[model samples]
Target: MPGGRPPSLRTVASWILTHPDALPEKERLKLKSVLAGCPELDALAEHVRSFGQMLTQLRGERLPEWIAAVRADDLPILHTFANGLERDLAAVTAGLSLPWSSGIVEDHVNRIKMIKRQIYGRAGFKLLRKRVLLAS
Candidate 1:
């Protein structure tokens, strides 16, 4: 109420996702009070923390158990997320557990898609190829 605007959605989401010890003292106290005021939010916090641990620890073998726990909660958004993960469960498990990732390849593919969109109606393959090559 004194110095700056309230925290933005991104900042709030980050606070919820980050480990408490990583947050500044002020932000940690604020988050503690907020979670204390709402039991549902408190439960959501626990679930998010558990999921974060699973990701960082490469415990993909716990995917099914995690999904089951999320589904047991009354959280519709997380339930939808769990359902989506179920659709490609094997890939999701592999991605979570493996030490390697296709992230770089995926980023390059995304870059090419953006470049194609930029030149879609304006260029022939020769020009497009030149631009794509130049993009690298």
Candidate 2:
């Protein structure tokens, strides 16, 4: 707030989500200061870090406990997210527990969509089809 610009939302978000051991001293200090100033934020950060661990470690079995912990707190946004997960618990758990991902299929679909948009109004179905096939 004095000599330089404050960190952007993305920067601060990374600091919170990133493992503390990996952070440089300066960024860690900033994160500490921010967390110390707000108990709610500190709690949220702890819960988020735990959730991040669950994701990275493929510990989907911990989801229920995590949801309970989140609901115990006053963080409404996180509560909403947890609620959404509850509605489709099986799919979410399977996604977290499994090593496989549908990302490649999703990416291919996105590429096709992009190619279609790029060729829109510039060509007919034939040209669009050629480009899409070439893109594959």
- Compare the candidates by TM-score and give the number of the best one: 2
Q: Pick out the ten consecutive residues of candidate 2 with the lowest summed lDDT.
A: 1-10
| Candidate 2 residue-wise lDDT, 43-117, digit = tens | 999998998888999999999999999999999999999999999999999888889999999999999899989
Residue-level lDDT for 84 in candidate 1: 98
TM-score of 1: 0.85
Q: Write the per-residue lDDT of candidate 1 for residues 22-130, one digit (tens) a residue.
A: 9999999777776786787787888898888889999998999999988888999999999999999999999889999889999999998999999999978998789
* Candidate 1 off by > 4 Å: 1-11
- Model-by-model lDDT, in order? 0.87, 0.91
Q: Give candidate 2 regions above 4 Å deviation.
A: 1-9, 121-123
Instruction: Please tell me which predicted candidate would have the highest lDDT against the true structure.
Output: 2
Candidate 1 at residue 77, lDDT?
90
